[model samples]
Target chain A: MNTPEPFLGATSHTPVRHHILSVLVENKAGVLARVAGLFARRGFNIYSLAVAPAETKARFSRITIVVDAESAPLEQIVEQLDKLVNVVAISDIAPKDALERELLLATIKTDVDNRTSLLDVVGNYGAAIVDVDAGSVTLMLAGTPAACDELERELESYTTLELHRTGRVALPRLGKAAVAADPD
Target chain B: MGGLFLYLTKRIIVQLTGAQALIKSLEMEGVEVIFGLPGGAILPVYDPLIDSSVRHVLVRHEQGAGHMAEGYALATGRPGVAMVTSGPGATNIVTPIGNAHMDSTPLVVITGQVSSAAIGTDAFQECDITGITMGITKHNFLVKSAHEIPRAVAAAFHIATTGRPGPVLVDVPKDIAQSMMEWWYPASIEELDLPGYHPVVDLDADRVAQAIELIRVAERPVLYVGGGTLKSHASAQLLAFAERTGMPVVTTLMARGAFPDSHAQHLGMPGMHGMYAAVTAIQKCDLLISLGARFDDRVTGKIPAFAPHAKVIHVDIDKAEFNKVRRADVAIRSNVAAVLEAWDANQASPQNLEVWWKEINAWRETYPLVYDEPAVEGLLRPQHVIESIAKAAAPGTIVTSGVGQHQMWASQFWKFEEPGTWINSGGAGTMGFGVPAAIGAKAGRPDRVVWCIDGDGCFQMTAQELVTARSEGIPIKVAILNNAYLGMVRQWQEMFYDERYSEVYLSPDLPDYVKWAESMGCVGLRATNIEEMHAAIATANTINDVPVVIDFRTDSSEKVFPMVAAGASNDDIMVHPLQREQS
Candidate 1:
């Protein structure tokens, strides 16, 4: 008689270090389910997850996952990622090589008619006014995933009825390129 | 004597480099033969292989080699190995690789990759084989250097065979394959921390005692076996427990051959297509002892109604599977053999529920599994086709099936006399798995009959397999239960979709699958009626040169009953002969 245990064994191990993994996956329905299922099945804690289309053609998507692990099982993660059928490749980029791993936020309508103070708050945060219609102004800001979230929290009091936020996206530093060695 | 010893030692060290070391590494890993296709990327390895003791069976297609390797591994309880070249050659094996991964079959797939220089440049015959196979395999490797080959091979074998067995791929660059290096077999595995690798073999004493007490106090108990039993090779331990407790046992589809069919205590498969007696027993029993079985939806029916009267005790090697669906009174995370051995030491006779057994026996007699009069009038019944195959299929024959009505019928009618005789994608429920799995099975056990049973829809999905089968000269018989439609979906729509027939009718006209088979250099036959079915079977049985597809059209309206509706629990089974539609 075999007894079943937790899919992810005992939770006794000390938390290693937090790892931020950016993934490029084929855009498809249930892709998230497949990825999430693998993490659940393997028993990995996902501190944060953000997703968006990587390419405008909608063929590829980017998923940013922040995991609390001492040493990430990168090989196993890549191995278990069968859910993303169209995933062409996966790589872990050094944090320093990230030029812009950030999210963009835009609030269309704000009660700047009565609260002119909201405009000052947006300006203080180095946010841009993308559109100004009637008495309200549309503010836009781009920053790191956490920084963008922080700025939004402070802007919540400005009657922020409509808000649009872009999930985390990143590009390698200008000089960095991955190339395979030439065949002799 | 000293001079000879020195000479031998020096020669052994020299032989450990280049292709010689590769052959020795494979031999050390216990790889007896390789099923593969040869190409430029892999010529160096094969050249050395020709001089080595290892055997290689050249297959027509790379995919066939993968299937053959998987089959050999399933048959021998060892990892099956397949080798191939880059690009199409490597990509062709993806389907079988996925098959092994889903079925938990141990397989080793070694592909020759393009030289490192052509890897990302997309040069002639170059492909990202490692990337392509990543998800389908449990693990994968790209041998960047010759020194890494032996260690990578060792690790691949270890991972592929340990814990939950699955396929692993190692793509060796062409240059690396030809390079010479000082080969030192990695003496031990580095402690790669796998979260789920719990090495403790003993069952928790407290849990075991609790379960024993529960069993002793229970009035009625039934034991359920699952695929894990066969996977762990724990049939003997399970049999001992059954005899000791006089417990009635049933199995899941993947666990079909776990118990002898003739055993008096056997209750048959339980779930959607389970036996009437088995379903009723699961529903009515006061205590359920499950061994190495996952409570898959097909088995549990509707969760709330499944085993409502019973206190479940689920035993499985996977910790996450325990109480994941059905809450168990006692759940143990240990190997089947280990737990059963532990239980044997602390054995106690349980109180007998004589009346319950009598009732179960009465149900079995009254609802004895019978077919619809053998379709003697005109039509071919799927049941008849299965029975005919079973009669023709030799003992220890390999039966693989694709999903749908035909799969269920084959599982029910085929009397598997031994473990590992039946193979299918049970958990994944993948259609088109039959023919390839059969290909794999035959490659493993060349002397045994490998029958591929599929529904018309399922057969058409991977019918391309005929090319591989014919070219490989593996005599696997393909039996198609053609009902002229998606029978399972049609049945569902008939019962639930208001009988609209919607798009379920596969009636644009079947493009002479027989001709299609012949075009692929394989034999094909059609069974329009009962008499012709016999003829088709005869034809299939006689052909030993190539794979044959026998298309047998049957009545589409027939439903696989004694089904416990999804989530309805085991007791609320809807038996065939319609007691009335679900309210």
Candidate 2:
């Protein structure tokens, strides 16, 4: 934390890394705001954050936060979160042993000339057209973060009227994913 | 779990308002005292508090109330509590909240809110208090309904006093406080199962064995203890560990009383203003067993050079502290006391550290903290005044300090004889902390002598609280090192910024401190020379019935010595500004 801030775009010497952390916290109101306030105050970059009840009882909530690790060290981020009383536990869900997904919605300008091309390009990325208009098409896609990024890039050539992503949600591969190691 | 189930099944819930429920919950938690101020939004909570046994000490300002609660927490190993109204009151206490957060003090702060309906309407005295306090608090809650009071109060106390203790807040809106609800004394609050709130209370055996092994083989080892030892009440354990192993222990400013400062193996505070030998010891140590010490920037002048040669075994309750500033060879996440109890190691004798001790003693002899008579006649030396107070302070004196040169001087000069004897806003470096905190400490420990070592700049910040002490008959003695400047900042400007003292000087006409103390209905005296200082101290010592204040006009130009310039490595420590060439 005492180290100087690195440049925005990480150089090869310090390549940007995506760190997915599964945080378990008390299912209480305003907890989300408290967690978000911490990140805002400390300037810890959050790529995406998703929260929901972890169990049927609704006593606890699981927050999957995808952090941009080029900003702060992973252990420091985890330690800061651990200081929050509502936060119960935080685990790094290694990408290799985790299931990660994000939802993307894009409202595109689809005129008579590019409507077919837009639909064909969306089909190539396994996305569904949720709404359609004579001059616009709203498409929704749920897939790996990379896949969603790829689909967004693919549709860039066409006029993208608007776009929104649900960030990333992830769960660790449980029951001893054979080649996993826990930190000491 | 079974008790909670039984409590739920058999308990008879009675209707009560939020305010009444809050009082009952606090009583259930064995809260014996409260320091607070009443305001429009918090008036409802005060109504029921009258009927309760909890003694409430009305303070002049919310900041005083907050620091008082912090002092109470430090004195008693229990959570200190504060109550204030919303908006201005909530904002006023932010300093103390930040102070507690930094020093790891346990406190539960309750603020009165505007009516539930008026919350977001920008009604009179309404502020987003919970939102404003989120960054400084461990956790906070805004009770929207009367029914949430019991659960919220339970959770507040639970979270505030547990783990790496910090301040937790519960904001009760005026309507919610007035509204009626079914209430039962929660018998199961201790068993309240909030998932993911687990605090590590035990050490891993392997890590313990590994630490013991490191301690055994190390030729030049140092025990770096911090506030956690005192926070966890592991001071005795630390003393035992140091004694059993015969290792020299250096306590940080926050950990002043954790180990007896007079102990044979004790090295004074290690930091920018620490003893030369202590700082050098860290730089040269081979195995650094850091017990509950976070390598704070102040403690570690230059990160990479801090204990560079040492292999560290960092133990703390907050695992986030691991490698936060300095890397550790072995990290143990457990309560310091519990780990100390579980850890076992081979016995060590001084014979083993014969050479290491020789080196340490040589450094101590070579770099002794020294101050010659001030070149100007009649100009009192700050260090001389502090040392005199240290000489006069009785056993079990609880010393509180406001940040600046005085704070470092008090830490350096005072010989803490026991744990829970030194209380200051260490991590937050708060000014105006001394006066109110001393009053709070005196209130908590009436039998012991409480002293406030304050700087002139710091004393002016919360000096109004002296009125509270006078009215309440909290007889705390204050020793003001009246150096007419923000001494620490002036020193920095002198050393680093070429002495263009920028706004660091306080007006010489800032009211005679003696008259100011007398105006607050306290005995006041002024000391100009060493003889006058001793005489004034003696006079103050006899008059314990009322608060005493002594204004010792110390030299404005005297700077704290053995300072490692900010952002400079520890090895580059300098005793004087002109000697930077050798440094």
Best candidate according to lDDT: 2
Tell me the tens digit of each residue's lDDT in model 1 across B348-454. 44778688789999889877676667767766888888998788766788888888888888888888767888888786676677776687678767888888888
User: TM per model?
Assistant: 0.73, 0.93
Label model 2 with its docking quality class. Answer: medium
Q: Tell me chain A's TM-score in each of the predictions.
A: 0.59, 0.83
Which candidate has the top score in TM-score?
Answer: 2
Estimate how well candidate 2 is docked, as a DockQ score.
0.50
lDDT of 2 by residue, B1-583 (tens): 9999998789576999889999998998899889899999889899999899998988999999999998888887788989999999999999999999889898999999999888789999889888888988887889878887888888888888777889998999998989899986556745454555655555688887777777778989998999899888898888887777789999999899999988988878898999888999999999988888889999999898888899998999888888888888888888788777666344433238889999999877777677766435576888888788778878788999999899988888788988888898888899999988888888888898999999989989988889889898899999999878999999889878999999998864487898999999999899888788889988988888889999988888888888888889999887744444544
Interface RMSD of each: 12.8, 2.5
